[model samples]
Target: MNQLPQEYYQRLEEIQAIDFVLVELTLYLDTHPDDYQAIQQFNQYAQYSQQLKQAFETKFGPLQQYGNSFSDAKWSWGTTPWPWQI
Candidate 1:
């Protein structure tokens, strides 16, 4: 769940793993785009990253808002207190 207080730490690990996979696949594909294995891994990483981003935004606020703010259970507008306040 994104409910963990250690969600940031989990995110850090996920980021590192995704970065490594992306870097390795990109380097491999530089001269070998036809490598189906690398292409598959790249796609997998991209999907995983997108899921993580959604979880982060759901737990925290969006990186930025549209015309209307996202409604969250814990934080909303000025009702959201600072980290210490939480």
Candidate 2:
């Protein structure tokens, strides 16, 4: 398989890190239901994740089979090289 671009891996890593933080914040919020700070941080991370996903999709195509990530210009999802194959 060919190597994927560094930016693709970097973006994926960032998204993964954000997801991890969101999960941890969710657990904390569950125990401390009134922790407004944690809630705010969680929301921020969630929005950031969405933005990251959108950017990734726009540049590299859909990460998943379903969603708004698919382009109308052409079916790039199946045609574009997979990350592992790149």
Candidate 3:
């Protein structure tokens, strides 16, 4: 397989960062459910994370297995190196 570009790693990192924020917000909101600002932030991050994942999947193949992601003519999941494998 060809070497993955720098942008691939950058985008993955962005997704990871957003996911981290979402997890933290989830924990915080669990205790302080009345914090409207935290709830809003969590929703925003969740949406953004989905968008990022979609774009990444479109360019680099599925980020998940099973029916969670779509496949083209060929299954790229097993063909390409996984995110951590790179």
Candidate 4:
């Protein structure tokens, strides 16, 4: 298999980091639903996550399946590397 670019890992790491933050915020909000600050932060992170995923998918491929990602005319399932591949 061909080696992937450094940017791929970088973007993936960023997404993971944002996702972690989102998860933590979600848990906090579950118990503290009145915290408007936390809610705002969660929304910001969620938007950023979507943007990052879209950019990553445009260059690499879909990060998920089951209608979560966009696809071209040809099938991309077998073309892109899986998360565990790298």
Candidate of highest lDDT: 4
> Pick by TM-score: which candidate is best?
4
Give per-model TM-scores: 0.58, 0.79, 0.89, 0.94
* Local distance difference test, each candidate: 0.66, 0.83, 0.90, 0.92
> Model 4 misses residue 18 by how many Å?
0.5
Selected candidate, larger lDDT, 2 vs 3: 3
**lDDT per residue (tens digit) for residues 1-86 in model 4:** 89999998999999999999999999999999999999999999999999999999888888989899888677786687887888
Evaluated at residue 65, the lDDT of candidate 3 is 88
Cα RMSD (angstroms) for every candidate in the order listed = 6.4, 2.4, 1.3, 0.9
* Consecutive 10-residue window with the lowest summed lDDT within model 2: 77-86
Candidate 1: stretches off by over 4 Å: 1-4, 62-86
**Whole-structure CA lDDT of model 3:** 0.90
Task: Write down the TM-score for model 3.
Answer: 0.89
lDDT of 3 by residue, 1-86 (tens): 78889998899999999999999999999999999999999999999999999999899888888898889788777776776688
**Per-residue accuracy of model 2 over 1-86 as CA lDDT, tens digit each:** 45679998899889889989999999999999899888889999999998998898888777767665657487777765665664
Q: Which residues of candidate 2, in runs, are more than 4 Å off? A: 68-72, 78-86
Q: How many clashes show up in model 3?
A: 0
TM accuracy, model 2 = 0.79
